[model samples]
Target: MLHQPAAPVGKDPAQQYKMRLGVWMVIAYSLFYGGFVAINLLKPLLMEKTVLAGLNLATVYGFALIIVALLQALVYDAMCRAQEHKLSDQKIAGEVR
Candidate 1:
């Protein structure tokens, strides 16, 4: 016996938008992360200095990176969902006409 997918997978109309959005987001995140690496490479001692709440620069920056990543993921998801919804509505409206 052969099994089939529950629903047919159609090509995403939001593919291009999603790809562009994703690439931009990745580049933004990479630039932010690169700063951390630059600091470590140029001034290793700077990481030991307390920046906030008695947390060292490295610790604070590391935590901030994690938070930023999570925030970016959420924002990306919201934007993609909105784009997909808008495109889907347009497709439906087109079908009705």
Candidate 2:
């Protein structure tokens, strides 16, 4: 069963915080990705150099970017979940008192 939040949805401070966090995360990703793309375009030869036996710098960097994005998403999700849990606990405590 979905427990009703004790606070109003629109005005929840935690929700607002989460929204800002998510927006900033997106902006950060954009900057990081834009830099990567810019580097690739500016120095094609640098990106093409083989870093490992079968992987070039471009391929490695591309994979790293994907991993970074995935990690950021996981972190954001965890942070939101933590905030939600905190809110839930506060509501439960209010009911008990």
* Number of the top TM-score candidate: 1
- Native-to-model Cα distance after best TM-score fit, residue 44 in candidate 2, in Å: 2.1
TM-score list, all predictions = 0.90, 0.74
Q: Per-residue lDDT of 16-86 in model 2, one digit per residue for the tens? A: 87999999999999998997889878987888888987899889889989999999999999999899889
Give the Cα-based TM-score of candidate 1 against the true structure: 0.90
> Model 2: residues >4 Å from true position, as ranges?
1-13
- For candidate 2, the per-residue lDDT at 51 reads 93
Each model's lDDT comes to 0.97, 0.87
lDDT by residue (tens digit), candidate 1, 9-87: 7889999999999999999999999999999999999999999999999999999999999999999999999999999
Kindly provide the TM-score of model 2 when superposed on the true structure, using C-alpha atoms. 0.74
For candidate 2, which ten residues in a row score worst on lDDT?
4-13
